[model samples]
Target: MTRPLLDQARIHPAALAQIGSYHTDLIAEVEAAVAANKVVVVGMGLNPFPAKARKILDGQGTPYKYLSYGNYFSQWRPRLALKLWSGWATFPLIFVNGTLIGGATDLQKLIASGEFVRLLG
Candidate 1:
């Protein structure tokens, strides 16, 4: 049998360090929220992916923590930096129990395949 997703999941040390509190207290708060919550969604601007992810979570009767940072015109750089480091190219970087679940498409795939449910428990 294969190992569980959570069991196989790992955050690279270099990538973890790349996060490095870059957004003052905002990123810190996100980190703290992620630590406290089983499901966490990090996004940029008023992105639709986060909403989509939330809709899925809601449909699944699961509670999730949402954290959005930066915007389109002025402050998107920070979120871009987050993407560069985290290897997620889009909004709604979903995480379950501190494991990266990626963006909206990734979330959808996991949910459709029943992996999301398995990971949750």
Candidate 2:
């Protein structure tokens, strides 16, 4: 059976840890965004694995919107701390259910193992 769009989006806590943030507000926002039903996200920069990860997610029945890194950063600068730290510069920043879901590599690992698809279902 096919999984629902919202169900396809999931933000694992481990993934969020990859983001370095002393403030909890943005972290909470990321967690909430990524955990949301549709899992809308911005691909902040050029990354090696995001396309593959997106393909895997698409194949597994998850649908997502990819926002340009430049545009995303321009709009979300206040919430993000790229200048203050390295947290904002990371690629493949995922937002589902109002939460953050790490990078492409992590997502790829989860999908390859079948855990992500199963969770989607």
- TM-score per candidate: 0.73, 0.46
Model 1 pairs whose backbones collide = none
Q: How high is the CA lDDT of each candidate model?
A: 0.77, 0.54
Q: Stretches of candidate 2 above 4 Å error?
A: 1-36, 71-89, 96-99
Clashes of each: 0, 23
- Badly placed stretches (over 4 Å) of model 1 are 1-21
TM-score of 1: 0.73
Error of model 1, residue 66, in angstroms: 0.7
Q: Please list the Cα RMSD from the true structure of every candidate, rounded to 1 decimal place.
A: 7.4, 12.3
- For candidate 1, which ten residues in a row score worst on lDDT? 1-10
Taking the tens digit of each residue's C-alpha lDDT, what string does model 2 give over 1-121? 2433223136466654644344556545444455555655555444555566577667767787665434443645633543233243566665544445567776777667875555555
Q: What's the lDDT for residue 53 in model 1?
A: 85
Which 10-residue window of candidate 2 scores lowest in summed lDDT? 1-10
